[model samples]
Target chain A: MDAALTLLSFGPDGWGDDIATGVLVTVGLALATLPFGLVLGFFVALMKQSEEPSMRLAGNIYTTIFRGLPELLTLFLIFYGAQLGLQQITALFGEETTIEINAFAAGMVALGIMFSSYASEVFLAAFRVIPRGQYEGAYAVGLSHTRTMRLVILPQLIRVALPGLGNLWLILLKDTALVSVIGLSDILRQTGVAARVTKEPFLFFGLACLLYLVLAVLSSFVFSAIERWAAKSGGTR
Target chain B: MNAVAADLVERPPTPSRRWTGTRIAGTILVALWALAIAGLALYLVQSWNPELFDRYAGRYWSGLIVTLQLVFLSIILGAVLSIPIAWGRMTKRRIPSALAYAYVYFFRGTPLIAQTFLIYYGLGSFRPQLEAVGLWSFFRDAWNCALFAFTLNTAAYQAEILRGALESVGRGQWEGAASLGLSRLHTLRLIIVPQALIVALRPYGNEIILMIKGSAIVAIITVYDLMGETRRAYSRSFDFQTYLYAALIYLAIVETLRNVIEWIERRLTRHLKR
Candidate 1:
């Protein structure tokens, strides 16, 4: 027990600091991904709803391709395939610089793109639920198209999108563990290293499980609170 | 009134003929874009190494078979195990419900990869104890560990889904059964379960799809499933095409399953559509 405690301590002999850093990296990846995902998702949703058939088709294909592929396969394709594609493009431009994508950036882009595919569906559903009268009402008030969206549609969209987005967030949080396969020093990867170095897989992996559970539980509470707040605010509006 | 009447008179009688130049252009552009995509796909297929396929075809086939096996066995076993857990959650007893909740919470909260590692490597530390109990052989193999983890994880999800579906069966159904002098078990077996299963079908399909995606993680633990074989081929060739091929195969499987599930859903709910 003492040995185990010492190994988990923050001293030079222990990997406590490493594990802490891993947790931070995982959280940072998720935070960075959230906005990218939401913005792209909103854009895709708009494209799907566009007046132009081509735009709708494009959006449909994008969502179908991304959503159909496994998240891990998407990561690998982006991480390795992106480099090759970039190198080819640079060669065409007569440049010699080799572009490298760090695991974090690759993870962010892959996860963000995948998240957007799912989120677009959620946003599209939310958009569909808005009464047609609301748009007509906005027009009757002499609001511009953009102004109508901002004043009349966006708030309600967010309220309806919140729960689905929250569920996606939980999924995204768990998916960050997959980044470890690409050598990101996230919680799972760090635990893997500690386990290998200390030759105590049970101790380290079990601890990693506990850490993940703590994050999951805490995030669930946070989401529930935000949902309640969204409901209340939406009611007032 | 004159301007409104003029506008109405000028409009085309047929909607199809009302397609302006811009609309025609949009249609043309969409067609051109689709052609470009088709051409790109054709180029990739032509460029693919046929010799490589011939050499690794057997390996890929076996990998695909293993992946299907893992997904099928785990989903079936997990679904079976979920019934008791779902029952525990639904019961009035506090302790059982809490225990079931804890099981679901822990499994759902963590990543499957973490759970896989904990079972595969973590249990290696307990080989001596397992051997003492004559279970070391079961824990020693990576395949068994992967199967075990997948089963446990899916059971938690399936349990929650089943519980929700069962509860969604209206209380009136239970009351009607009781008033008819049917016992609780008989009611559940004869009527409630069938209805609950129909309600649960879609979610069950979703869970299976998720497990199919998640079974990829078992590759990390040295199970030479589809993803594992893909990785192996990639390492051998150092070509990204291997990954694309694997992705294409996965996409086919997912698309097929999606269609199958939709068909089943339609068949099950055919009565409601009327």
Candidate 2:
């Protein structure tokens, strides 16, 4: 009991810093992925919404392929496959390439790409909810497609997509732990290391779990705020 | 939520019929663009080594089997456990409901990898305490530990699915059964569970697919599931393309399961068909 307590203590001997740093890395990588995913998702959504047949097909294939692949496989592909592809590129350029893609970059690329696929679906469905009349009204006023999209469609799209996006963010936050497999010093990896060094798996892991719970609770409040904002904005519009 | 969904569903169809020759050409153009990406990927793999298939063929098959087994066992156990958990959550008493809610929150809040490690390594650390209770034998094995965590995690989600389905069952049905002098248990067993099963079936199928993908985490805990096998195979041969091939196998399983889920959903909702 004393040992378990000591392991969880906030002192230098404790695993607090290590585990906390892991949580930081996990959150950082997840946040980095968010914007990239949203952009990719926007394109996919636009492709999905396109009147052009070929654009829809391209979008469909993109979503289908990524959505169908397991998250782990996607991670491995981006991590190792990207590494190998880069090496070959450098070789062709006659440059000695030793610039390794670390676990963080790989995690971002993989999760960002995967998250975008799900986001596209959310955005697509959200767009579908807007009545055609709204789009027609924008067009009737001689609004250019780009201007109409900028002013009318994007705001409504964000409102409709906010709930689903909230869910996706929660999912991405939790899934950051998977990057630990590729050796990102994330919370799970840090906990594992601490567990191994201290030989007290329960104490460190239990702490890690608590930290994750706290993270979840904190973000849930953030999501609720976003939800309220979206709801209010939705009403005013 | 249901009201919004109902309104959306009741919305009349758009009178846009832009499907034309130009649209067909556009579709082909987009398809070709995607094919170009796929083609590039294929070219890279093929150029890297044409014999990559033969190099890791055997290992990929075995990995595929392990992934299927992992998915099947966890989901089956999860489905079985969901009933009691959902029942506990739905009960009138505060304790059971709170306990059920806590279970859901804890499992849902953490990552699957965290839960997997917590069970595999964390429980193993308690070998002595576990042995005192004669559960050490089970805890010693990675497979058992992985299954325990997966099942518990999935059960939490499944319980929520079941709870929603049960709540959505109309009060009219239960009252109607009561009018026939049926006991509560009888009414629930005959009417409630069957209806809930229909509503829960599709979500359950989605959970099963999620479980299939989730089982890959066990590879980190020293379970030789698909990912584990692929790592081993690649480490031995240094053939990276083989890993790509392994990914395709996972993709195949996902596609097949998706079709299976769709078919099951269609079958279950047959009554609503026009």
Candidate 3:
């Protein structure tokens, strides 16, 4: 136990800096993916909510493909496939450009796509809850359909959607570790490096788990607080 | 939250032939979606390599089997373990409940890869002690270690699902069953469980789908699951088709299971709808 303490102690002598950076990268990756994912999801939900059959079909197919495919596979595809596509595009310029795509960007894009697929479902449900009366009422008051959705419906839909989206955030936080496989120096990979160097896999991996647990616990507290506020706003049950 | 689930019962809205501006945007979106599909098709055709199918077909098949076996066994085993854990979580005993909560909290809070490495590489560091206890061989096998980690990880999730489902059952049913002179076991089996099963069905389906997707991680540790096989094939041929095919296979499995579960839910709840 004493030896464990010495090895893990903060400073250049230990792995404190590496692990700290890993935590930041993991959280950063998740945050970067959130708004873009949420917006994509909102559009997909709009597609589903639209009266056109083709639009609804488009939404259904998007969710089915992304949600069903493994997250790891999706990441691998984007990481490698994007590189290939980029290489081809550069070839058109008559110059050899070896582009090693950023692992962080690949992870963000892949996870954002997946997040959107799931978020669309939540958005669909939230959008569905707004009574048809609200739309008709808005139209009766001379509001355009676009303005009604933008100003009236979407605002109320957010409160109902908060809890579900919060759960997805937790899932996304845990999923950030998958980026490590593509050589992103995330928390898991940093701990893994520490384990290999010190021959203390148990110690470092245990620390990684504890770090993730703390993040998850903290997020849940924040989400529950938000949920309570949403409830007090009198939208969702 | 149930709000996250897609509503299968959503009625088709009444047809309106009005060419609203929103409808034009919808049409444009659908056209763009079709164009994307066409681009993907073009890419697939352009990248076609029939040689990959001839060489790694068997390896891919075997890897898929391993993935199926691992998830199937872990889910079944996890379900068994969950019964006691869920009961513990729901029980009046403070110690057992707290212990159960801690177990679930730890597993749910941490990433699966972290848990997997802890069991695989972490336990490897304890070989001498494991050998002393005669469990070294089991821990040494990557398949066994993956199974153990997955079982434990999934047990926590399954337990939470069970506890939530059971708790969602109304208190009036239990009192009514006791008044009917039914034993505690009978009340659960006859009066409460069937009702809870319906509520649990979708989440249970979600868990199974998640496990199927997550089982891909065991591949990174060299257990040669589908994702592992894809990695190997990709390394050998430097082709993206390998991962694409594996993705298709997984998508097929998830979609089939989803439809199956939805069908079962409908069939089981046919009596309750009226």
Candidate 4:
């Protein structure tokens, strides 16, 4: 027990700092992917709801392909495939530059794309729930399409979307761990390192689990609070 | 004219049909673009060394079989385990409910990869204790540990789904059963469970799809599942196509299951459609 504590300590002989850094990287990766995912998801949702059949088909295909593949495969594809594709493109430009993607960037893009596919479904469902009359109502009031979307549709879409998005955020948080496979020293990777170094796999892995649990519990509380707010506002509207 | 104006004022505007030459051209352009992308993908695949694929075909098949086995076994065991957890969650007893909640909370909140590592590595650290209990053999095997972790993790999700489905059953159903002098167990078995199963069908499908994708994580623990084989192939050949092939297989499995689930859902919910 004393040795375990010493190994986990922040002192010169310990791995506490490394583990903390890993936690930070995991959080950072999740945060960075969130907005990219939301924007792409919103775009896909619009395409899905578009009047044009071709646009709708494209959206459907995108979601189907992304949602059908495993997240690890997606990450591997982007990490390796993107680099090769980029290198080929550079060659076409007569440049000798080799474009390498770090695990962080690859993870963000892959996870963002994956998250967007699921998020699009959620957003599309939220958009569908609004009555057709809402659009007609906005046009009748002489609001332009952009203004109507910004002022009216966006607010309600978010309220309806809050629960699903909250769930996706949790899933995304957990998925950030997958980046460790590509050598991004995230919490899981750090735990593995610590475990191997100290020959105490149980201690480090258990610590990692406890840390993830804390993050999950804390984030869930925040989501519930936001959900309550959304519900309240939805009622008022 | 007055009558016509009043009619116009009362009626909703007709949805305008605005398909023009430009719209047709745009549609053609989109179709052509999609076709071009598909053709490029086909060309790339066709150009790859078929010999490599042929050589590794056996390995890939075995990996796929292992993946399917793991997913099926874990899902089945998880479903069985979830019933008790679901009951605990549904019951009025404080201790069981709290215990169930804690289990779900911890399992669901963390990454499956983390849980897999914990089971695969963490338990191995207790070899002496496990050996004394005659359980070292089980903990020492990567496959067993992977299966155990997956079963526990999926059980949490399945339990929540079951709890939700059970709660969604109307109280009237229970009252009606009681009025008929049916016992609680009989009511649950004959009426409530059947109804709940239908309600739970979609979520169950989602859980299975999720488990299928998540089963890939076991590869990290040195289990030669689909993803594991892909990694091995990639390292040997240094060809990125290995990952692509694996992705294709995964996509096929997910797509087929999705269609099957949708068909089942439609069949089961046929009564509500009318």
Candidate 5:
């Protein structure tokens, strides 16, 4: 027990600092991706709802592909292909500048795209959960489409979408570990380094699992609270 | 709207989307999609390499087999293991229930990759003891570790599904079975399980697909699954399309499985269809 404590201790001789930094990185990565994913998901959900069949088809194709592919595959695609894509675009301008996508950015983009695909489904369902009356009621009052959505629909939509998006956030929190594979200094990576150096693989990896579980359990609590808060106002009223 | 939702008074009115139909939104979406689609086509044309495709075809096939094998074996084994766990979860007994809950919570709470690494690397620390117990060889292989982790992970999920499905069967079924003088076990096996299984079918399909997508993590540990093969090909050839091919293959499998599951659902629930 003492040895374990010393190994996980807070000072220079211990890896506590490194692991703490990793936890920060992991949490930051997830937080940064949240808005990107939410916005992209909202956009795609709108795309699926568009008047044009092509727009709808594009939405369907995007969701199907991103949601179906493994997050790691998407990460690899973004990591390797994004650079080439930038180079290609630059070539068109005859400048040929190369843009390298770091693992953190790649993970962020891949997970954001994947999260959006799933989120769009939740948002779509949330929209559907709002009764036709809400739209009719808003229009009956001569509200513009944008106003109807903003003032009347979105508040309720967020309520319906909250639970689903909350679930996605927990998943995103966990999936952040995947970026460690591409060389990001996330929780798993830090623990992994300590595990190798200390030759105490079980202890370090178990710690990694514990940290993730703690995050998930905490998020579950936070989400339920938010759900309760959101539901304080009546959906029907 | 589905007739059932419409007919079912307690269910909410079929939810309707509040869409952004402003012409500006539509124009922006069109422009963005067009650029995306056009760029994809250009990239495909510019980077098509026939020779690399021919060279890596065999590797991808073999890797796919490994992936399929890993997912199927673990899923089957996990299904078998989940029976008792599910039963424990449903039982009135305290110790068994707590243990089962803990098992599910831990497995479900953590990431698959972390779980995978723990099994793969963590077990090696017990090499001496495992060798003494004559289990070193089994724990040593990356493939076995992946399989073990996947099985443990999927079993918890399957247990939840089983418990939920079994509970979804109405209280009347139990009363009907009891009045018929059937034993509890007999009633569950003969009547309740069948109905519950039909309810469980869709979740089972979803679990299998998740397992397929997740099995890619094993490649990180050098198990040479489909994703593993892609990484190897990428290292050797440095072709971005290798990852694209794997992505498409994965997509094809998921799409195919989804349709198959839907078809099976239709067939199995044919009697209930209106």
Candidate 6:
């Protein structure tokens, strides 16, 4: 029975294909959501820095609502609510079609939103850590605000932000499991389905943990390499 | 508008230059969000079928009670258990410290879902041996098994947080206490642990919020917590809106807990001048 659970056999027979598919999806979801999160986080961080009463207020509200809400709740809210809203919008066009949002997209949106809130704080903290002298030096060089940010602030921000970004990546990788609830065929979901079908919950779950352990270990190695590379670049450009 | 008021009271403005586009965008965004929230509230009120609520309210209530009980108990047990784990890590020993590190690394490395499954299902594999050892009775109940998993997992993370807090107490401070001829235990209990607790309090509060959310994962087991109940409702009714309702309940619980955490952090740290 244990030998039958090997990865290569057909579905409902061996977990090989399922485990492989789950890992790919998990990695895919994590990689896809990361950039979207960074972009959203950048805007939020900028908003957090806004001097205007309203801009700061909006930024604060965005972070507060998302941060206060559980990752699972946000996933459900956007998953169902977004679908319903899309359906309503289609109805206005007289199509009257029920459009379904894919579970992967919904999961990405939810994870992206959550990660953006946290990454914004990381960016904000990085922004604060930039030496005031650098900005003044950029000003002395007659660099415009945008150029100054790109040339001076960003390079330093990335350096200070590397450790945090690494931490965020690890977190996002783990959180990809939340997609299991939305019915995505990720590792956890695959394990769950296998558990239900095979009635061998222990085998599937044990395998799932081993799979995650592999991913976590593999990711730490990647992050450590990045950390070393970042350090070797001599602090800041 | 009211939400803005709530937000502002919690986070006072740090002085910065006001930008016009930022203001316009900010106000529009906030207004849009407020409108969306108000709309959701109205939809819930208008579309709420009292019969449906009455029918499922029992399960929801039962689930809610279970959820709270599970979270509260795991945290209490996790808190008590974490101290020794943390102490073992901090003490100048090789083997115990190594074991402590391994425990934290393994648990923290994996997802809580994996941890719970591994505990409940993985342990169930050794049912005969467990029974022989007289431990199967404790592990047989889904709730007990889930509680044990959560407790161990939380203790690992908490141990790290506590260890960091303890290490942050300056070397001089430890020496100062030692010079006063205080015993090692006295220095730790009276000086080191108290100060560390004060520092650990905020992070620990955050952990509590984390555990509240984490408790939802126990639903995968036969134990019916809030999320489990939500899943059951959705499966039965096939209405995704039931999930939204569940999410809102979760959001409210998290928001209220977050506010409490912030209030406590501020109250505790008030002595440190900003």
Collision count for each candidate, in order:
0, 4, 0, 0, 2, 1
C-alpha lDDT of all candidate models, in order: 0.90, 0.85, 0.91, 0.91, 0.91, 0.85
Which of the CAPRI classes, incorrect, acceptable, medium or high, describes model 6? medium
Clash pairs, candidate 5, are A128-B15, A128-B16
Query: Which tens-of-lDDT digit does each residue in B157-262 have in candidate 2?
Result: 9999999999989999999999999999999999998898888888887788788888877888888888888888778877676677677777788889889888
Provide TM-scores for the models: 0.93, 0.90, 0.93, 0.93, 0.91, 0.89
Q: Say what the interface RMSD of candidate 1 is.
A: 2.7
The segments of candidate 5 whose C-alpha lies over 4 angstroms from its true place after superposition are A50-52, A91-98, A235-237, B1-46
Kindly report, for each predicted structure in the order presented, the TM-score of its chain A compared with the true chain A: 0.95, 0.95, 0.96, 0.95, 0.93, 0.93
For model 1, the docking class works out as medium
Query: Could you give the candidate ranking by DockQ, starting with the highest?
Result: 3, 4, 1, 2, 5, 6
What docking grade applies to model 5?
Answer: medium
lDDT of 1 by residue, B86-190 (tens): 988999999999999999999999999999999999998888899999999999899999999999999999999999999999999999999999999999999
The positional error of residue B189 in candidate 6, measured at the CA in angstroms, is 1.4
In angstroms, the error of model 4 at B229 is 0.9
Tens digits of lDDT, candidate 5, A68-105: 89888888888888888888888999996768778888
Q: What is the DockQ of candidate 4?
A: 0.60
What is candidate 2's lDDT per residue for A1-237, written digit by digit as tens?
787767767798888777778889988998999999999999889889987767787888888888888788799888988888898899999997776899999999999999999999999999898889888999999999889888998999898898899888888998888898889999888988999998888777777788888989999999898889778867664
lDDT (10s digit) by residue, model 4, range A42-155: 988987898777777778888998999999889988999889889889989998787778999999999999999999999999999888988899999999989999988998
lDDT of 6 by residue, B2-118 (tens): 988887786656877555665778889889878978887888888788877877889988998998999899888988999889988987899988888888888888888788887
Query: Chain B TM-score, candidate 2?
Result: 0.83
Cα displacement (angstroms), candidate 3, residue B250, comes to 1.0
Query: Which candidate, 2 or 4, has the higher lDDT?
Result: 4
